[model samples]
Target: MRKHMFFSWAVLTGLLLVAIGCSDVSEPTTPTYETNLSSDEIKNSAFKSEFPLHYETYLRNDESEIMTEYGGSVNHNKNDGVNPLPEGYKYAQPYLKNLWLGYPFSYEYRRARGHTYALKDILEIDRINRFSEKAGLPSTCWNCKGTKMLEWTDEYGDSFWVKDFNEFREDVDLDENTIGCANCHDPKDMELRLYSVPLKAHLESEGKNFSELPRNEQRALVCGQCHVEYYFQDEKFGAAKKPIFPWAKGKDPEDMYEYYKNTGDTNIPGFEGNFVDWVHPVSKTPMLKAQHPEYEMWYNGSHGAAGVGCSDCHMPYVRLDGKKKISNHHWTSPLKDPDMKACRQCHTDKTPEYLRERVISSQEKVWNQLLIAQDLSVKAHEAIRMASEYTGPKPFNYDELMIEAREMCRKGQFFWDLISAENSAGFHNPTKSLDTLASSQQYSQKAIDKAVEAASFTTARDLAGDIREIVPPILEHSRELQMDPDHMASHKWFEYIPLLPESEKVWEGNERLTSENAH
Candidate 1:
């Protein structure tokens, strides 16, 4: 009987080995970035080795592994607790195409993924690579990607901003670097330090020195280095476009808008002048694209006001090898923690499942309303196009009407982008998010009404007829806009939760649970 059992086990083991040998497990799907030249490959091949204490092997390739493990089979939405998107569902809002028309983002924009993917994803985007001769990207674009930025800044100083993106792409083999240990750590002690020059300068301009801040505040400020909204201003440092944060006025959505509108009145010395990121093709309004302002948004929230730093939630300490406790370097959404250790640290009353439901419920409310704002903005653009060509009678002067509608467009887009671009869906501060989305919807609707009213003077009724439902035929429209022909065809969403399905299907909360949370 013992011999028979041993033989059976041996045969099973043999079959498993054969199956493993035949599988593609030996070949990893992710590109192998190994360089042929070990020490001789790049000039600063061992640059990080110079500060051995500061550098650690931080690249965990955690996106696939973690998403598969904690996030549920690689297709689950980390925050919302939803599985992969269903058929015919698009991860990107189709209205975004209309909103960003005449801009590179209109060609392609995907939801952000892990820190490890930052450089690779940017390099692969169609928005930056539509043209052959020059990639539609500036060197300043690399600011948030990785730790090697310090070396590049030391070498080029301010001239780095003007250099074409490809210049650095060719010179620096990006496969070797990421937002690693060196980015936030000091070389000697591994203590936190802010390396972003723009952030340091901006803080100084406000008479609030970053280094003088308390350690807890500094932790979040390190993240603020890249997470805040900034614009590239010409001739501030050199001819190169230097990134200037609009913090002299304030950090709120309204404050940033006012600062952008009246740049000459800025309290930040030496940056007093009007700035324009891009002119909206449809509305002709000079638009501001609010980058992920997570720092700014959180700062205005209750938690941040209570001195909770970003690391508190996102980089909670985890025990490694069951002995050494260290902050998790795989910076990602805290919701992916199956153990709910991070959330439970603060919210002792709630379970992981409850927290997940609360998050999805809050986000769903904001997102559904956001889509309305988007649709309104699209219609506003169509109305503006009609009003521009109209030789109509004037209740308000044509140019004045155009200016008014454009102002609405500007304000609407600003509010919408603030909420939309922020990494956290409304969970950071539900009240603030809802309020901002409300303003966005109000402004968007006003823009549409203003545009339609102006277009009424035109003799051609068909021109302004049914401006509603005019989502730009973006798939076909890109061809007319001179974008890459194959961009839409080649568009790819992340494997995890690629397309958010209907709320009922993706979200798993009952009415009783919803009622319980409402209180």
Candidate 2:
């Protein structure tokens, strides 16, 4: 009997090893990220598959209902214990650009709680099936949320891979219900992990040991898996196709533009014609726009200088029941709990006033400068608009003025990015934030004025207008910086979750395949 039990244990271990492997938030505020898809609808789905049936059997055999036990409260709308999404879910943008920027969930709640909010495994697929039918969503929506679900996507990727979340969820057969512990944290060893082929390809090419970085740093990088902004270059185009980080010359936005200039060859997109942003409705000289610009600007600030990463304060590890170690997944700003151990770990001071003072002062300086950026941005837009009007659509050389305005606008946004990065705006350094913004704005305004004047009838259109690009050899440098292990934007979710092979119905191989192989 003892020998039989031991053999049973070994078999179970092997099966689990073959099971899905690999891989927050805050809130008394209630995890704002609950499922918008109806649970009843999901639970009611009629489709049954080998994946879903297998998960159901596993759950029944294991009796896993940890969500109700772990989560302190049940979701109010879902009516059952599994929490529904926040009130804001109705308005969430499909492409969620601003999310995971350290907002939504609080830090302590994230630490205290693991992911007890969503469906997983086969039951999750049932939920996916039901939810899609009820909510009118898609099954492809299940991608990246579960190993089994991601497995189902094998061979079917080219068609449904890039499809939107709702529509995707509705059409596909899902065993993966949503993002869960099995996706980010290694349930077998319980370390945060990435399961992508491209990430390692890029990292190794640049000599990065993703594991060598400190745990705190690791925490921040983990956030980068989904948090940072990225776009697919499209495999069909034979372009890089893999997700490209914007940091060739430097992580700075200007550096990114340097790469985008692509002056070396006519074959590159938007290079020879010298396109930047769409005709600045205001500053007619094409302007380079920005999304959040948080990652780069944050790096330029003090916290980053001190080697502080987002997870140091936001995803601090806490011991539960006196011994279990886990980092909080709640993805919110650390400032939410000032007195708690969160920010105090680094600040080393007890007084809220002093902390506030520091953040305010730092932010003020940056803010002052940012104001200049704002002024420059608005003024530059007007200048461009005025220039375009003066010259008509034929394209004239407001080059000097545009050079001035574009630089300022770029700097202003950079400053703003820095401010928004730190909790309490650089531990209360509003003064510096203000100062930086102010300076940037002034420069931007100057550039706009120059461009506006140049575009006037007094100047002839310089078809030969010299293209003076800033910061040389942008892409080479950007690629190098992007592949750096310490950098966050380096994450390549594009390859992190690949479609499974059609021949294999299994979610995982018999063994842990090397983390990455070919790009």
Candidate 3:
């Protein structure tokens, strides 16, 4: 009976795909609303005066990071957009390239930029272009980049996920679609409303619903829409694309590890366990990439325990003109603000200098350990590669041992990502950050130990000694890893001018394009 039911569903899915292919109507093929409210009605209900729906307006009026060089946050002096790295941020791309050599991230993954650069950066990234001429990427890439996503979701429905990313690039108006005020703003009153499909679905599976949550919880939920880790679950389905959050068990880094370890195939409803994002080329282990999980980190930290929302620290309210006050929507580090006023609001006893040092101290500690984790992880990969490739006598089969090593790498990288991928540099929850890093260190060392044990099975016993010797030199093997040391030296592709000329510069490299559709 179960087999028959699945067969029936497969047949229905096939029929639906056939209908989609045969139709000439390529525009959004789905209903826009679940209720009687039209788009205008929904807008009218949420906003009164015209809400500045475009983010460019805000960029022009107030938050001109390009114009002010993020108010000297970029490089300790006001200059331009081409170099936006904050003070003390060192280039880690060469290290990451070794870590993710088998994955597309190795092609290009820079430190994240402000919200305004979201769409432009993604469009310009080399990872997306590696196969853009052929397979390209899935539409899921557009999920957080722009406000056009909301419109595309309403128009295409489930079809949105299944379509090639290039399809939307060709079909939609990219310029007007960049993420803007309309995304989180309610058109009627400008109150925040959740629009993330994955967040809504994940919450439902966890036995909670977004709409029913209190205003405060909703604040966190709003951030969770894009900040949480997720994976594409229905890739094999071909016709249905689903981005699922593996939060059935919980949101902790360990909880997510367990969820990914035990969750089965998409055959199961609501839970995707034992998923594989990509198999590591060098480690040969099935791996999962951790997205920026600020929400999850904050959830496990002191602030969250104290019921402090993300906005309390990252987005603080400020008074201007001595009378009018509003929540600062610039969304940057509170410590970087001119006076450290946000921290003062909470810790009135601390001076701005002390608070700056406090945050920087925590970040430096995590950053240093993160590099150690990177070094150890790279060794784990080399160890596995040596063990598997050893051609000396007794051609040992270390399949099980390799599996063990991969699991360690899995946990190790996950923990590293918990700190490294997270937007906050450990300041959000210093204790949790350190604890997570300790786990990464432990897991990484275990992986190295397991790899050594496996390599000992080599027919030439001396090969085991050599494998041990080989592991220590992995960090210095950058040339062998095919990673270029000069990866961070160039930012020539970046455009720094804000609001003037009304459009940003074109990429101008191979297929160089602008955030707007024009060349």
Candidate 4:
């Protein structure tokens, strides 16, 4: 489920600088791959190879402006057997939300008004649009921009376009950016090329209408487009539904769900409608779970509204010795190397701690909310199980119940991601985490009661059916926390990374640890 864009290929496959101007031939393009400066002296570890994670960034940097200077590694520990880079390199922790800069990009953007880019902020579409306006981007530049949602047709296809995932994989290249240059720009002619077979398949899926949009819109269609969040439903599940944006109703979570419900569509059909992403464990009512929502939320925020793009902040122009070129495609937070023109133009406060503290504080706040949401959601499921003992089953709506369960599971997942996306853990803004947690708790409790209410109608005669049948898939998919590895591991204690004791539960399947085993 985790696409792993950053951690997976953040440092993989490099582009070879071919004979600079003689690139108009039909020769196979070659790439130099991961740069050597990446690996430690002769250490050819995958940590430095294909899809390598630069140990240097993870190993060095200590800006006094914040608490931790170095981008702290989940794998960093004395016993982990590797000595980090030279001292003065403070820890730099990251949330997926921002650029991997060493200093605070947000604070700078705030001080600069509008000319500057908050390079360390999360990637957004408008940001790119503005950048394109500032720097002339040719038509071919549109390649790596988006999902290319060109319409297909009114007529259905007799055979599947992408018959299976393997065929899909062969045709698509996911090596760089989970997207990259070759997808759009012609490496050979510096022109644009479209594979008719592939585009034809796409057109047919949409009732054959690929060329309906405006020229610039079509040009803008590639690259930055798919960079947004989306929902996918497969043809096998119901009728063939192609990947479509749910924005016809409107944007924002509430608006989208309103459209789905009005459509009389019981569920997503494939993903199980279950309403929105997940349900609260405590609040039994269906709830909306949010993802990066990078485009929507970022646009509404001070950053995107002000006009910032993914490349503007995270992937900015870097002067190599004096010749200017965009920083290599190693996508990460700009905070990892702050003071770049992208950020420095705004953040006049040159201190590292100042920058780090800001992001850390924000991260911490998000994590706290995550924990609260997770705990309450789990408890609500337990409540569902308890309530089930008193219910009856008359041709239970298994379809609907599963829908509910999937929603709750996702709510729990959202918390985990919030933690993961939170760059500063609890350091960014402690209050932010506290505020979100409080609301999350309230919402979760509300969900829990709803599930109990669902089963309250059961009679003695209905008891013969699978107790699970009436419980709705929401409770069924809760995965009995005791047996889930993530849930079980969540209870274990770490000297450095601690969990709330109140949140801990004894494993139903595992035995207690002995004194010797505890170590």
Alpha-carbon lDDT, every model: 0.63, 0.39, 0.61, 0.35
Off by over 4 Å in 1: 1-57, 65-91, 236-239, 264-273, 457-468, 472-519
In order, what is each prediction's RMSD in angstroms?
18.3, 19.8, 18.0, 20.3
Worst window of 10 by summed lDDT in candidate 1 = 504-513
Per-model TM values vs. the true structure: 0.74, 0.50, 0.73, 0.45
Q: Please give the clash total of every predicted structure, in order.
A: 1, 93, 12, 100
lDDT of 3 at 433: 81
lDDT by residue for model 1 (159-189), tens: 8887776556544445556565556755444
The most accurate candidate by TM-score is: 1
Model 4: worst 10 consecutive residues (lDDT sum) = 106-115
Measured by lDDT, the strongest candidate is 1
lDDT of 3 at 160: 83
For model 3, the superposed segments whose C-alpha errors exceed 4 Å read 1-57, 60-93, 170-175, 235-240, 264-273, 393-397, 457-519
Error of 2 at 141 (Å): 12
Candidate 4 off by > 4 Å:
1-162, 167-178, 184-224, 234-241, 262-292, 325-328, 338-341, 391-440, 452-519
Model 2: per-residue lDDT, tens digit, 280-342? 322333333343334444555677667788766666655555675545555434444456566
Better of 1 and 2 by TM-score: 1
For residues 447-472, could you state the per-residue lDDT of candidate 4 as single tens digits? 45445555653432343344234332
